[model samples]
Target: MTEKTAETKVTEAQRAALGLAQLSEDERRRGLLSIADAIDEHHEEILEANERDVTAGEELLAAGEYSQALVDRLKLSASKLDSISEMVRSVAHQDDPLEKTLAARRLDEGLDLYKVAVPIGVVGTVFESRPDALVQIAALCLKSGNAVILKGGSEASHSNRVLYELIREATAELPDGWAQLVEAREDVDALLEMDDSIDLLMPRGSSEFVRYIQNNTSIPVLGHTEGICHVYVDEAADLEMASDVAYDAKVQYPAVCNAVETLLVHEDVAEEFLPEIAARYEQAGVELRGDDATREIVEEAEAATEDDWSTEYGDLVLSIKVVDSLEAALDHITTYGSKHTESIVTDDDERASRFMRSLDSASVFHNASTRFSDGYRFGLGAEVGISTGKIHARGPVGLEGLTTYKYHLEGDGHVVASYAGDDVKPYLHEELEAEWTPGDRSDE
Candidate 1:
């Protein structure tokens, strides 16, 4: 098909999504709850379709065409489906992000100004093998009153197709094409070019893939290209607690982006903490590559090079470094970190405060595991994706991130001449406690 043909589909979808944008908050909330219930009721169908995708993924794994991580993400169990349902329900119950008055000011008597949140029109999301992302993105879009066009990896095609169908059916009573699925790879290329209809593009995958989307598309992109996350153990950290937190951060879910890939330890604590953590990592089958000082403390660790510092292993392999001071650790992270998530384990409150304030990552933590950097964990129901970019949205993008605001001015036949002429009515720009309620029109 021609480019115009593809743009027409997106245009239709955007039109449908705009209809949803005009809906009352209660109407949208009930519609999302209904979609969540429908998903739960159709869990078996989703699981059956997921099994087909898993089988295909296994074949690809055996042929060396797919990584173990992709296969794991492609497979879906009953519990995962239930969790997806729960997240959908949670999003449905979240405060509607649309039409809430952010600020109000009285321009003059019988004239008022208000800023209200609204949807970002149509969002085009291209994600990799986690089929559950299809449901998560659709639910968040519906709750935020944005239309979305989803393109999931071919690895989970069967699962994504089933999930998309279920979501479309569940929200059928609303707009006709609020949630559209584009399965073909060529369609993604077409989508990247449709900047007019698609307001935002969120691509979730490798750094290269995200960069490719950002470079190829004129549509504003909102997502992290990589997640070279790190965890630092300060000199004042309790060695036992440091080891526990570090172990959990790497092993809780190594396949995810938030999993810590680099571990930095203060030189004062390195000798004692290194061996303890190394032994624990051994038990978890984690491979360690470290700097000269770290290797001196832990003989089992392999020699780490400059490249190791910036690598996102996304596996059990971890790179460890020994920093002489907190300043050195911060400098190391600033040079190599992906600005996704970083954490410092320390008992020194002042040192922790400095570390937290100085770092520029999306999420900074003190005395916590980096694994805690998640949307569900942050009580955002679930995320469309994590963004390391500093504009529009940052960190876990949930309902609030999916929306933008519009300024609404109400006036009684007010004209600029009244405020500008010699017979000028002195203008009042007073802040008002009054907000924009539904059906409050100045014309009435």
Candidate 2:
């Protein structure tokens, strides 16, 4: 622990030879598609390796050191391996994000400002037992024109390593290094020091871990620190639809970031709605923790406290509060909610519109399950993380989330002096009358 083993660095020549993903977009997509084929072809070896990792993870579970749910998530299932292959195809065939010029302006007579898409260069992702993240982060970065270094937890190390091998072998067709896996847990320190090597770092797990990486690195991070999501059943809501959306949001996938952790009902509906919703949660095995007002209506609910309202229990746990008005619901959420994803199960267009505008969350749904806050559901080909933060990216982070734009100037020997000259009057700009369309270059 005192002195580290002699560090090895990628030599300039070695780095050039180790082709990661600096290929043409077509080349990158072909590489990723081949990975999907390889994964399907080598499914048995991957599963056997994953089984061994899960078996060892059982010891960690029996000691009460790790939750059984967490251990379960650590293991890859038959269907999930299939999902990885599907994601690879999904990302491969999607529209090219890099093809579009997001903005274009005539800066001068000849100097034109063309904002073009560029890669984040190199990425590092730190996540827990979710082995699928291996393919996700890799595929996302590759398609978006960047390389990635993935670090999955030790619980799923064997599975992760095997997956990495498939991706590496599949993407080896690239003349440039497109993806790399840092296998050892001890490599984390060197990872942090890789500000020079890595461009952006995204950590997906606990709030503490995300916060630690955020505080430690000066490199920009795009991720959610936590998922204390909420769902507010407004006064004008349709009783049946509201109940269905709320119940599904909380109970469908109770252990994910988008699962509803808190529910707020307006006073107009609280009396009739609380008991109805409580019964549904009971049927779904959800533990309802209610505030005094909610308890008065739903007698069986355990009393909710300030702590319960603020807590993000990624289990069958929910906190309910009764609000006198829509304003109160918004106020409560603005105060305690995690700014992750939230929804208003209201039929009234005005109310839904107002609530959507007022609530400051990444994805604000209207009469829909909060659980639908996902990449595939939103038609995003794949997602690296569900970002709750507001800076670079927010909501379901797909390929579009991982990149930043740089100004590409096409100048015909014109200088900024042309604009700075006293004789020159800057021409007022006008919108083009025709429907604006970016000419397709990716296909060409």
Candidate 3:
């Protein structure tokens, strides 16, 4: 048997992704819709595969090899599969993200320039547990006219493989191997080294795992390392509303990345709000760790350590703190936050505005739970991931984030020499309204 090298597999996948990129926007959209339909039609098959993975995961959990949170993330219910299908349909309904003219300028007579959106070529994503992510990534990549290589965690290997097979079959007519799946753990190292072939890398997992991927890969990564999200209850906040928001942020879905792991209460409200929220947390079986001031109010709260402020405890655990003022809260967030999500509960508009503006996280909120910082809830149809990085995309990365732009210059025998020397033609740098029409090539 010929030994297949990692480089060989990546090269093959990249070639397929590039081929998919050549598809027209309309074709890409159709392909996405087709995949969605296929998912709906084959839901049972996917569920069957998911059950196998879940059963295996339960055994691992019983053996103490996996956390309950990992088991929760790995399980795929029928509703989740349905939601995944709907998300694919939503991506198809969105406006085509390719070839949109972002800017147009008339350089000179018969010479025009255009900045247009285009696909980012090949995208490589390594995600954990959630097999549904495989569908989301493939749909978003197809809609944006990019090829994708997905590597999901081994725990969900069966489910991921089934979903990948469905997506590949649906997209088979468009471009050969438009979606590729790599399941081997060793392939991750190989994929990271293929920077020349992969344009972007998105790793979704633990902080340490994301860091490991970033350290090993030369490919540009677009993901947050951790989500140490927080919700601050301002002194002027309505105590009832603040308590409700804080509770929802932590208790609604404690295992996800967007869940709030820290709660900051103002000194004025700490005496009243801490005990109330603590009672609520206790009802939900959430363990509360607090600072000195917070511990004084909630006697049951264990004393929080410095490390508690920075940890992303993706479980039913929360760290609480009491600050003298909003500024103190902001300082604490600045020092310990992962720049993922932060929320403030305040009735005062000025203070709310200030908090929203001053916080430097990717998604900042006022009078809302940190849980609202989601791609689907934000209405990007679906998100590839939440990006904390500042360069390409900042918040929920949808189809727009999956794309880059190209400069398209059009001219009829126009030369730069005409505008260079003395007595040269005057260059006209006038803005013009332009749209990309089919068959409009730069060479034209």
Per-residue error (Å), model 3, residue 178: 1.0
Q: Over the stretch 228-337, how does candidate 3's per-residue lDDT look in tens digits?
A: 99999999999999999999999998888889999999999888888888999999999999999988889999999999999988899999999999899999999999
Q: Per-residue error at 71 for model 3, in Å?
A: 0.9
Predictions ranked by lDDT, top down? 1, 3, 2
Model 2 misplaced stretches (Cα beyond 4 Å) = 1-22, 108-110, 415-444
On a 0 to 100 scale, what is the lDDT of residue 425 in model 2? 60
What would the TM-score be for candidate 1 when compared with the true structure? Answer: 0.96
Highest-lDDT candidate: 1
lDDT by residue (1-444, candidate 2, tens digit) is 453221232222125323432456787789889989999998899999999888888987888787765776777777888998998899998887774577766544444555676666777788887788888888887788776767788889899989988887887667444566666767766677656666788889888888878877777777656788888998898988899999998888777788899999998998888888899999988888998888888888899988997888888899999999888988999999888888998879998888999988899989889898888778788899988888788899998887777766555675656566778767433222221133321211
- Residue-pair clashes, model 3: 0
Ranking by TM-score: 1, 3, 2
TM-score of every candidate: 0.96, 0.89, 0.95
State the C-alpha lDDT per candidate. Answer: 0.89, 0.78, 0.87
User: Candidate 2 at residue 241, lDDT?
Assistant: 87
lDDT of 1 by residue, 1-444 (tens): 553455666987889987999888787888778877887898889889999999989998899998877787787888888898899889888877888889988888878889999999999999998998999999999989998898899889999989888888877789888888887889989999888789999999988899899889888999756789999999999888999899999998888899999999999999889988999999999999999999998999999999999988888999999999999999999999989999999999999999999999999999899998888899998999999999899999999999999998887798988888678788789887766974354422
> Which sections of candidate 1 miss by over 4 Å?
1-5, 438-444
